[model samples]
Target: MAYSLVAEIWSELAFGMLVFALRFFTRWKYSGFRGMSYDDLFAVFAVTFWILETVSLYTCSAYGNNINLSVESALAVPDSEVPRLILGSKLAYCAWIFYILGIWTLKGVLLCLYNRLTMGLQQQRFVWVMMVVSVLTFLASLLWHILSCYPTYRAWQIKPYPGESCTQRKWNYVIICVLDVVTDIGMMAIPIPMLLRASLTVRRKVSLVLLFGSGIFVMICAVLRAYYSLVLIDDNTVALGWAAREFLVAAIVVNAPSIKPIFSDFKKRLTENYASGSWKSGTGSNAMSSGLPPYNGKNDIENNTAITSGNHKRTQAYKMSSIGRSQPKSESQDHINTATDADNDSTNSNIGKDGIIVTTEFKVSRR
Candidate 1:
């Protein structure tokens, strides 16, 4: 059971890290190093603490005391094993701290995204409210674990049998679980009204809502973890496994919107490759006789068109003009890439009132 649990934990962590890498690469590719934002930093902090939590989790599962042990069983534990138990207990405590930090840091990442997405809009108000709620909830959970366990050391104490409050940590789990779900709901709520009002098709709006609402799965994980922790109060390994699962779900959900670009790019490349292959197959004999490169439609367009903004004086109006995009209410990779292209073409093109021709990216850095 332990080996299988460990395998599940590590496999989930590897997948989470892959999505995280794509998120980071997407930001770096479009925005560059200078474009690194608070969300990026928060993502770094989140992954750091999650990795630490996993290390502590492995140690606890390997050596920690079983919460199911009765007072008699605890007392009967040999002195030789007491040291290992104590180390496990301490690490378990640290694991909880790491888990708290890692998950809450992910909240910070989402809030940063909301802050940027809602800039100059009425939805900014909700973002502020949710940010305050997030900070309060984070502090509440952190303090509960720190102070709820009387004398601190009692949390890990085995001899004399520390009470279930210190050992099982049911109440602490409840508090964190409730707050975790609440904050997730609040974050999901922020972008929804805006998306509904967005000038997009029903299908597009629904897709965007579903994307942000992916946090619902994370909330479900938190609830299940809490439910089982209270019911299976004796199983330390069960609780730890749930912790890892919740973290994995939260990491993927929060990073989903950020990594959409990767899927989009992959789809585009696949289409191009298929089209190129079809073109090559059709012109097999003629192309071989000419000994020239295959006729690619995409290359033909790129080579034929030179996007030049004739010597028309650049106007500040283009810079000042309000810009909007048909996308989820967040700073997406597509928008970022389009904006980067606009920046590169700043010297070459003069965008007039019809700003639709050129996309301008507005980044709100405030957290």
Candidate 2:
């Protein structure tokens, strides 16, 4: 039973560490570790507090848990265990509160991301409203958690005390659970209508929907956590494990999106490496820069540039030349010269499809 408690702590800790590594890597590599956003800040806070809460859970389990025992056996617990139980109970209570904060903060991370994405739309108003309501709910929940018991201190009393009373929080916790799931669903659905109306292709819309749909998985985790908490609410040890698992899931759900750009960039780099390695001669000084096999001299480089600059024309000529051997060779050369003349006559402001799009952009100018 004690091992079970420590196992949950270890599991959550490992998950948190793994996410933290990814988050940190993403920020360092993509964001240039500058101008941190609300989501970034909330992720760090959620992860840091979750780790602390895990340590607290470990402390809470220092004394062997009394979960799932007969009522009679629970009553017969030795007086010597009470002090240790009280200490553990206090730590567990602290962890419970921190866990709630961590979940809320993690939710904030996603909500903030949504807010930024919808900032220029009518739905932005709805996003702001949701954020306000979530904050108020979080504060109210915190207040209720603190004052959850009569005489408050009685809530943490490992031993029974005369003239002290406490209120059962089973239904109260169920209410919190319902609120969490509802809010999660609302947040997940907020972008759909707007995305549908946007000037995007079906493929883009579907991708956006699926990206936001990830929150549904987090909602499932919340539902399961609620079920377990309600069922094992009477058992401290079992409840602690559920709490840890729920927190880890929330952390993963919120932080996963932030690392998407990192994975995309890595994939892009691999593609570039493969393409360049296959197409370019590795022996040249500018080998890595070239997308095609090695050329002989400076003349070759200039000729290659000219060919690329007017690839559509070259391709057209090549196709025309292949169409019939009866076509005169001088006519093909004439076509190439005309294409070269057209390239020289073009300007940046009047660029055509043959011109480069210049995809290499300053990051600061992008969304």
Top-TM-score candidate index: 1
Error of 1 at 180 (Å): 0.9
Candidate 1, pairs of clashing residues: none
lDDT per residue as tens, model 2, 1-367: 2366787679778977898788767655543444357877887888888888888878867754333233455467688876776666567557757877888888888787777665445677888888987887777766666766656665556444312123235554676677778778778767666666654557965875676677887778777877877777666666678778778777776776666666765776687676633323112111011123332322111212222433542311122212111112111111111122233345334655454322211112211
Clashing pairs in 2: none
lDDT of 1 by residue, 4-77 (tens): 77887788889889889989987766456766789999999999998999989888888866365568988899
In model 1, what is the error at residue 254, expressed in angstroms? 0.6
- TM-score of each model, paired residue for residue: 0.78, 0.69
Off by over 4 Å in 1: 1-3, 273-322, 326-367
lDDT scores of the candidates, listed in order: 0.72, 0.59
Model 2: residues with Cα > 4 Å off, grouped in runs: 1-3, 64-75, 161-168, 276-367
